[model samples]
Target: MFRPLELFIGLRYTRAKRRNHFISFISLVSMAGIALGVTALIVVISVMNGFDNELRSRILGMVSHATIEGVRDSVKDWESALAKAEKNPHVLGAAPYIEREAMLQGQRVAGGLVRGILPGEEPKVAEIHNKMKSGKLTDLFPGGFGIVLGRELAYKLGVDVGEQVVVYAPEIRATPVGAVPRLKRFTVVGVFEIGMEEYDSGLAIVHMDDARRLYQTDGPDGIRLKLDDMFRAFTVARELAAELGGLYRVRDWMQGHANFFRAIAMEKRVMFMILSLIVAVAAFNLVSTLVMLVTDKQADIAILRTLGASPGTIMGVFMVQGVVVGVIGIAIGTLLGVVLALNLEAIVKFIETKTGLVFLSPDVYYISDLPSDMQWSDVGLIALLGFVFSLLATLYPAWRAARTEPAAALRYE
Candidate 1:
């Protein structure tokens, strides 16, 4: 159907000056709409992708890739477990930890989780060292009873480094007078800000030995493991669980933060659907543009039909014109979207510097910068959707043009 004659006529119709200025204006508007919709989809999706990555990295910075815990209570043989886990090629590092709930009392009172760690081995599984705001991890000696507080947690308790906070353990002690809560005085040696409110507001770190003493645990509660590739966390957790002979249960980072990540994924999907409507509306606008073009070209259609051009060839001509318009819009939009997404951060920075206004503040948001991560797959899918919608929009107009009565159209001309 798309012979040289049909192709030449179709392209010529696309480029030729139109007698009806309204038709030309509508065509231009339709093309611009498609380009705007495609650009919006690309930029929004890329920004969402960036947020997903940034949040994941921040959460995993404190949470281990995977962990093994004793089914009943403390893992008494955590040293052996750590040694065994390190044998696996996928396991990059391992550390023993004890976790329990406790109340911290300073100028204020707040509840938090107390994590016990061996200062020297802690870096193997977590990023506490780099996150520290004051003092050092080494300050938490076996007998020093030193503690590290999360930035928000410290603020909640109205305490900072070099201050003392009394910790009330869950266990009760039998006093001569009556039962009382077992407690200890701990010196705040350091503070760390994880940026995430969940961790920064509710986690405290201490030496493994101090944790055991406070919690009355025989040993560390579990062994935390960091994998070479975090995406393999679940598989490695299962293998470690099996290697340990089922005496313990293993949990991966995904399981730990399942709800949070799931919410992000759901939001991404919803945004994609919502933005797709814009593209669909822009594409369907082609129908109006093509219908008007067909109306204006009745004389041209009659001339082609009288010259023995098949109906299919006439239909192909209109289809080609419509498609050319759509392709131009999609190409321009795709090029602009990719460039914007790639340099979005720098662009944001420039705007902020020039305006002296902050888009994201560290004090208000965990992430203080606009980020973008453009994936080729997303771009390809968006472009394909635009093309398909545009193609579908042309069918009715092309079919109507093909069915025009040559004699009647000639009479009107």
Candidate 2:
């Protein structure tokens, strides 16, 4: 079998001993740099992706994907709106809701938004049933003032299931008794946890009838729609609003947390750009290493040229050598990244247990655990980009090698 002379020579040069220790040193640094950059990028991106995923699945699970509220009155025949919403191709489930903002006065007083829903109908819209920690959803069905509160909220209020908590809706009522505040007493029937500190600390659920009485709406204040695909929520919301015409107005979860999620996306982009450049700088070190190698092999280049080797072939030989180094670094980095991504949670747990420091604290970061989401597509892109930079780094040094004066360089030998 015939082998390409350039490839054979390039492989030889890549493995050959170097006379200049600095050349070897720079080559080592280049490889290490690429490895570090790739590894760090993978880990950080995975964590960011994990956070993004959590926001969608956990946070969104508790909140409505889109709310179609009656701007004119309490969603005229809310049941009919829910039925039609469920029939929409994009919508998976729909439920009627009556929401109110109130303060829970217990051992410790705190304010939060409370949502009233039917226990049986809620599972179709919100995943509240699944998030329950120590109680059942059915508890909310019992006639008078029964409720389910988020675990963190329960803890903060120093109240448990079966305890009475006073709810005060400041904006809902004003009377001669000094702004009556629509005071109501409710028994905590259950506790739920969704891994989001915000939701767990500031959300509660009650019976729709009770909520209707509090909000004074004709029926449900709005219909919550759950879409098959959450990413298309805004589109579906607009379409629904158009479908319902002047009677209803639609709002998506994206609108509710627009700035927060946008900040996260912007942060990820900036982080990827900064980290990718670290790999570029490392790959650029190939120029110095290859330049030194070309000098050391000057006589060989001259001999090969004298023996009829083309300048392009000479350039290919050096270019291939630089690419080989870069490819090796990329492969190692990719493998390391995959391993880390797969085991990031366990690794962090081990470290935290040993050091006694929390990585993600509910008290600080709104999440109580670490998260990782590895995307193979991101890995492929990182590897491809690293290789391209490494190949580009070869041009100057390879061209220098190709331009060696055959007669003059050979004369020295």
TM per prediction: 0.94, 0.92
**Residue 24 lDDT in candidate 2:** 83
What are the clashing pairs of model 1?
A: none
Tell me the number of clashing residue pairs for each predicted model: 0, 0
lDDT of 2: 0.86
Best by lDDT: 1
Model 2: what TM-score?
0.92
Name the lDDT value of residue 20 in candidate 1: 94
Where is model 1 more than 4 Å wrong at Cα?
1-4
Report the number of the highest-TM-score candidate: 1
Steric clash pairs (candidate 2) = none
Stretches > 4 Å off in candidate 2: 19-22, 171-181, 354-358, 361-365
